[model samples]
Target: MSDIQIRPVTENDHAAWLPLWQAYLTFYKTELSDAVIASTWARFLDRSEPTNAALAWQDGKAVGMVHFIYHRSNWSIANACYLQDLLVAPEQRGTGVGRLLIEHVYKTAKANGCDKVHWLTHETNATAIQLYERIAERPGYIQFRKMI
Candidate 1:
């Protein structure tokens, strides 16, 4: 963990970031069109976009990634950060990479004047839920959504 370095993604990091992104989608059992993937990567590189991404590197390799977005919220005057994606390489799980990535988001959000940082994990992800519970409060809000 001491050797792990987490930093914002750069244009040169696309090759390293793609596998982590693909692994994340595979973990969720989902797939996206190439266009959507391209657009997402573009947004991360665009400073004007609220979407942001960072990668955790170790031994000259990307071990994890996180994507977050800042958006307005009626509940608070300051913007809220939505941690949309987080993933650690299968081999790196339980090695503190996930927590490090999440902490990175918390720090970034606070620095950007965000009121809070929030995210959702599948209810079945017990391992992740254990970590999440230890670090953040469970708001007890059941998510309701429909794919339009």
Candidate 2:
């Protein structure tokens, strides 16, 4: 794990970040338009945007990516951090890359005075759930959404 370095993405990191982003969408069995993808990448590079992204690199190759957002929460005075997406390469799944990326978010959020960090995962993703369970508590809140 010492060789794996997790850092926030810079403008130069898009070449390294794209494939991982695509892989994440594929893992979730979803797809986004090119315009939406472009907007997302741009948000990470925009200083005024509350969205942020980071990647885990090992042996000079990006092996994982995490995207999070800071937003106002009615229940808390400080903003809350929502970890929107987390993905580790298929071959690197159990090697702690996911945890490293998540911990990076935790530290970043704390430094920014966030009230808490939270995320959701598909119920069928047991492997990730195992890792998540060890590092964070399940708040037992069911998510209900109506897509516009």
Candidate 3:
């Protein structure tokens, strides 16, 4: 979408990013503490930190956001970037905002020399799945997670 743009999130955007962050949690029906939200925003804004991104407006409003971190990858000798969270305002869904956010992540990963950018969403998130399929190859391996 011509109206959308992706940029490194700055500290000045924390206030704008919060409601979108909360919405991302709400989309998954989860909750997070304000402190954690504050910390995450601070971490992303900190230039010293590695591998993070957010999508904002060409029109000057924060329409959507994505936050990812780089980490070791056993499959690749080079590091990989993992998308931790992505959110588009509910009103902005289906308007190409999600794909733009994803493309931004890929561009960021490429610029950083990452082997790949990867992430997962709930199986039931059909809308995102549809968009994901359009932009990237399907994952061959299934994911399993356990909280220790």
Ranked candidates (TM-score, high to low): 1, 2, 3
Compute the lDDT of residue 126 as modeled in candidate 3: 95
By lDDT: ranked, best first: 1, 2, 3
Candidate 1 Cα outliers beyond 4 Å, as residue runs:
none
TM-score of 3: 0.92
- Kindly list the per-residue Cα lDDT of model 1 for residues 20-138, writing each as its tens digit: 99999999999999999999999999999999999999999999999999999999999999999999998899999999999999999999999799999999999999899999999
Q: Report the number of the highest-TM-score candidate.
A: 1
lDDT of 3 by residue, 62-90 (tens): 89999899888878888899888998887
- Candidate 3 achieves a global lDDT of 0.83
lDDT of each: 0.96, 0.95, 0.83
Candidate 2, 33-138: lDDT as tens digits? 9999999999999989999999999999999999999999999899999999999999998989999999999999999999799999999999999999999999
Cα displacement (Å) at residue 91, model 1: 0.9
Query: Residue 140 of candidate 3: its Cα lDDT?
Result: 75
Please list all clashing residue pairs in model 1, or write none if there are none.
none
> Where's the lowest-lDDT run of ten residues in candidate 1?
1-10
Clashes of each: 0, 0, 0
Better of 1 and 2 by lDDT: 1
